[model samples]
Target: MGAASVKPTSLPISELLSSRYPARVPRYQRAYAWNDTQVGDLIDDIKLLLPLPAGTRGHFYGGMVVIKITDSSEPSSNVYEIVDGQQRLATFCLLFAQIAARADELKDQADSQGDGEEAKKLAVLARGVRKSNLYYQRYDVDEGNESEQPRVRLSRVDDDFFQSLLDGTAGPPSRESHELLENAANLLRDELVTPATDATDLADARGKLQRLCDAVLLDSFVIHIVSDSRSSGYRLFSVLNDRGARLTVADLLRSHTLELLDDHASSREKAANLWDDILTEGADLVDDFLMTYYTSLTGKRAKREDLFDDVKDLIFSATKGRVEILAALQKMSGEVSTFKAIHAGMWPYVPSEHMQSVTEWQRSRLQRLVSTIQHKLSHPLLLAARAHSREDEFAKLVHMLELFALRYKNICGAHTGPAQAVYYAECKRLRGLTNGVAANFAALRKALNTLIDKRAPDPIFRNALKDKLRYDGGSPMKANLKELLTVLEDYRPWIKQGSSGQPRPSMINLIDLGQVSIEHIHPQKPEVIVPSLTSHTNRLGNLSYWAPSDNSAAGNKPFALKQPAYAASVVSFNQDLAELAAWDLSALEAREEQLIHDACLIFRP
Candidate 1:
């Protein structure tokens, strides 16, 4: 328990690491995987390394290989961590596989026509190289030891792109966006993987590259923080979070304060101290601390990253120093009779309609009614709302206001942070209710956390929305963007004016209106299923993304419906979201031109 020893020294990569050493996986680092090009190019590099010019000799693989090392303490074995260069190691294994494959191919071609004894000898060496590929080994998911063998697997991104590039059949867009993918594909095709002339040399190079990569990169001098105890390591782990990119909104805000308050040096120190004091003060559960902070904001329902720019005070964090916590304390304590004057700057962004329900005089009366009990219950109330949304799946206790509303004067009392914490725990345990009280609260509280934490909802889910909503094939607007823009230009007057004659900014960008395509639930006449036309017609109502693709395929039949031998052509339905207050799909059949015209209006700035 005394101060433990601490030291860091760089050793030759191999000397620093033990065979089994793996870095203490940083909390933010993703799991191991290598893309096809990295893997594919690596194999090709070994085949060509000997022939390459001296200037480019080490260029393929020299970078700082950092890892942390821990000595065998009183209890555990010595350990080393790989901080960088994982991809290089994995790629080396891939090179081994390709070298092996090329050797076998050469041997077979030579043997088939009795070309020479060299072909037979080459086959043997290729097998040896192929057998050494540890990272590419197929995953034996359930067998823990089988996966550790030398092999490589191409990443999902690499496989698809390489296949397309090699085939030369993927005619993707010519736009700025598609340019990168095409370039990457072209690079892989040209630089990665080559024809092998001598199977034996190719085989030798693979093994050498594999051993070199494993020794230098995997075993290299990477920095790992270590102490004598396991628990101490856990404490050090917290610093990794503090320093890493997986920062919470609160963490970002904490960092932002420094930049914002720098102007007034004294106030800057004050802001830093005050903010931490408030965060530490009467801390409930960490989650609730986040909820309380977010509940105090405007646009409480939007994503956090979306709204982080509104933090103007962040620019002044240096001046605010510890005093910045005053903003939070004022926001929280302002409802009391003693603090009315403190809130002159806080009210405009307050969203609750009920904030208007309490006047200064009434706040004073409420304060007198419960001198010791806090009257402000919004923080805990928001937790209750979140629990309610979860169908009481997470209900832990009665909300603070709900407790107060219990109607027995003696039992109905305002709750403290500690008491609220207990109630939150109770709500987490609350049971089934059909009224959705639990669910409503659950979603709202989640929204509160998003407001506070400030991260984007995962992009995976957003892309999933595109597929679910069927915005993939073509534009929901005109098939071509230029033509569609021309059509939209004709409706400028209809779009630009709002009800009050002021120019209303457009909502067209909310979803990509341009990319939407009009799909037919029914196939083209020859393909249309004849049996249930009525049920099918309404189902095939056309929809599109708010962006590039629009109603190009409207009234066109799906191809499969006519050829019964082929699969029955059912239309891939878009989610059919309402662009207007009362937009419906029937408009696609009758108001086609008008629909396009109206949809374009949604995007006007």
Candidate 2:
């Protein structure tokens, strides 16, 4: 299992897919997940590198395949378990199959045209594609019948579908094929067969198609690392994928966590089930959930590169016994569900029936706040508060967090590093309170307020907000601008009632709204007549939400001309702007004061 035992070599994609080394995907590995985007990216890379001269060796497609050699004695027909790079290998095969199909069509066309020499050359390419090492391999069985079989065998789930696709026998994608696999196959087919916009004749098209097929099969290469044992295979998998797209942290963690439960079959099964449940959303989300979970657990940000090591350390440090480790993993798995619910805006949908005290309204408010702030640092705090606090306490905690995040991040324009550290420390404090004592909502709020007051005191926040309004132009970050606009537009007095007999907020759900741009009420261009309003164009007073279409339509128009469009608008913010008679500096100043006043109450800490 040492590094020295791992054999690394480079081989042309043609040889790698050839009968000399047939690859198999083990049952434990995930099914093929490469979609149109990934397949397209690979094709684009190959096309970009196709112009390189022969023997130009170091052009990388950004991946390595690690295989465990099963039979060293039979070098020509060696069987190896594909430990990594199954996605790339499978995609390559699919792409080549499409190329081969195109070549066959071209050969037929050459025959019909009665061009003997061209047809002969086309036939050679067609045969090379059909008989390449990628297509078939020979296996030595007990019956001594050496028959050629599919070169690569996938897990049971996708083997038949993939083989049928490679052989061109699968008429349209069937239900048996995974959607991603179907997408890859169809995308490659369209890319290869569709004529380019330049409109080449059949002969020229066939020649170009043949050249591309040769480039991919003969010029492209993959760094192949073969390990003699499974242990070495896993090691090489980890090492090589650390730099490429082959394996992710979640994949590595799954392997490590399963190994930890080697002695307990039931625990191992349960753990695997938990892993699958978390990944049912998507494998990419596991890293996000884990990073947030780790931050909440330890009040420290975990870098992506060090995330696996950090989790390993955390697991080892939390418990040495298998039972304790299993319990911790189970708890973390539950936390992942909670995290997912929060991210999906399903706060009221608690998995535990007993933990449904948080009402849907409160959950919606928290969702709005998270969307407004657009930061993940507050996630750990929110997850912990939801788990431990009463509905009222959780509501208060959400308000405090919203105010703190908006003030520090949006108004003050503070550095995120310090704010993250502050939030992480508060998360640690809240966790300490919950674990050390019975759930004390009052104590948790008190502790949180104390920290918030120290870090972002009311006076400081108010001064910062006023200063930002007076001096700051529009927000640099679109999220911050949107958050500010949402707050201002949605603000309403408690006494107001809508047609439904509820609070008539201007904007109920900003999260689901279509694209909105910050429109200038008083045009910034010099042609638009205004009294001392040019310097204040980017201020909050001058900004209002406009649909991108409306924004473009109203571009640089004088305020008098724009007012008609604003009067026709539906947004309360724009309607209010239409009521204004003048577009002077005094009007801008008045609007600024009113907005600052509303902001003070909305963002009050």
Report the number of the highest-lDDT candidate.
2
552-574: candidate 2 lDDT, tens digit per residue = 47668888788888877756677
Error of 1 at 143 (Å): 18
Q: Cα lDDT of model 1 overall? A: 0.35
Task: Report how far residue 555 has shifted in candidate 1, in Å.
Answer: 9.2
lDDT, model 2: 0.66
Model 1, 1-605: lDDT tens digits are 23444343444333322333433322222223344555455445544544543324332243322233465430124443333344454334334444455556666766775766757566666654544333223334345434332222222223333234322455763332134445444433235434323234533544443443443333333343345443343334334444323434443444455334435566545555544443332222222344433433331332344333334243233344345444643433332211221121122113343344334322222221122222344343333333233312222112223223211121112224433443344334332334534343444344333322232122322222222222233432123222223223323444645324532323122222223333333433424354444333322133322223333333444433222311222211222222222223454443344443343223221
RMSD of each: 21.0, 6.8
lDDT of each: 0.35, 0.66
* Stretches of model 2 off by over 4 angstroms after superposition: 2-15, 18-21, 30-78, 107-149, 154-225, 239-247, 258-284, 316-361, 386-396, 415-422, 429-463, 470-472, 475-491, 494-595
| Weakest ten-residue segment in model 2 by summed lDDT | 494-503
Q: How many residue pairs clash in each candidate?
A: 107, 4
